[model samples]
Target: MAVGLWLVGRRAATTNQPQLATWRLTLALPCLALPCLALPCLALPCLALPCLGSWLLALGSWFLMSDLDA
Candidate 1:
């Protein structure tokens, strides 16, 4: 799970005093947010068609959150 990996990685980084790894994670957060930022491209009304991909987003959210509780 991502949280487990993040926790283990954080503990390891703390113990190791890994400055570079900290920077890498910090940099990657913004890049991960880029797609979400661009998602406004889907907001068009007439031709955009919200119904087109609503189900895909639902399935994607479920899959993405599946490992959270574990």
Candidate 2:
């Protein structure tokens, strides 16, 4: 579902320019990837304590990203 959204949004944003979309996606990758990584860390037992760290980092990163856009 996320991949589909990414593809649709990229296609719409770049029209027929695949390379442009790819480059733009590369820049956006970390923002998307970090939360995916953190979510699992936040749900597990072995890394339970680190879960708070992961959640906080994800929240901070998202806040900063949106703040920067404003």
Task: Tell me, by lDDT, which candidate is best.
Answer: 2
State the lDDT of candidate 2 residue by residue for 3-70, as single tens digits.
Answer: 85488567857787777666555544444566555445334424534655777898899999999999
* Tens-place lDDT digits, model 1, residues 1-70: 2364377568768889577556545544433444442334324223222433664698788988997856
Misplaced by over 4 Å in model 2 are 1-44
Instruction: Choose the strongest candidate by TM-score.
Output: 2
Evaluate model 1: give its TM-score: 0.29
Question: What lDDT score belongs to each candidate, Candidate 1 first?
Answer: 0.51, 0.60
Candidate 1 Cα errors over 4 Å, as ranges:
1-8, 11-15, 36-70
lDDT of 2: 0.60
TM-score for each of the candidates: 0.29, 0.36
Score candidate 2 by TM-score against the native. 0.36
